[model samples]
Target: MSRVVSRGLSAASGMLGGALAGAIFKQVWKLASGKEEAPQATSEEYGWREVLVAAAVQGAIFGMVKAAIDRSAAQSIHRATGK
Candidate 1:
C-alpha cells in the first residue's frame, strides 16, 4: 500500500518537476543569453555551441529538480506511513 502511494506521488511530482525545471531553465537562459528563448536545434541563428550549452543547462536543471522533488516525496511518504 505504501509502495503504491509512493508511486502515485512520484508520478505527480515528476510532472511538476518538469514544469518547474522548464521555468527555471527559461529564466536562467534569459539571464545568461539575454534572449527570451533558447535556440532550437534546427534554428540557424544559433550554432552548435549555443544549442549544446542550452541543452546541457536544461538537462542539469531538470535532473536536479527531479532529484529534489523525488527525495522530498520519499521523505513525506516515510513520515506518513513509516515505510
Candidate 2:
C-alpha cells in the first residue's frame, strides 16, 4: 500500500484508540470515585481542570500504546525490506 494510505489508517487507528481510552478512563474515574455515571452535557461542562487532568492521564497511556504499535509496525516493515 502507499505511504498515504498507511498513514491514514494509522491516524484513524490512533484516533479510535484515543477516544476509547478517554471514555474508559472517564468512566473508571467516575466509578472509582462513587460519582454518577451519566455522560456530561458538554466538554466545557467538565471544566478545564477536570478535563485536562483526565486528558493528560488518558492521553499519555494511549500515546504510549499507540507508539508501541507504530514502532512494531515500522520494525516489521524494515525487517521485510531486509534493512
Among the numbered candidates, top lDDT falls to: 1
Q: Which runs in model 2 stand beyond 4 Å of their true positions?
A: 1-47
Give candidate 1's error at residue 83 in angstroms. Answer: 1.9
RMSD of 2: 3.9
Tens digit of per-residue lDDT, candidate 1, span 1-83: 86697688778888889999999999999999999999999999999999999999999999999889878877887798798
Error of 1 at 49 (Å): 0.4
Strongest candidate by TM-score? 1
lDDT of 1: 0.91
Per-candidate Cα lDDT values, in order, are 0.91, 0.68
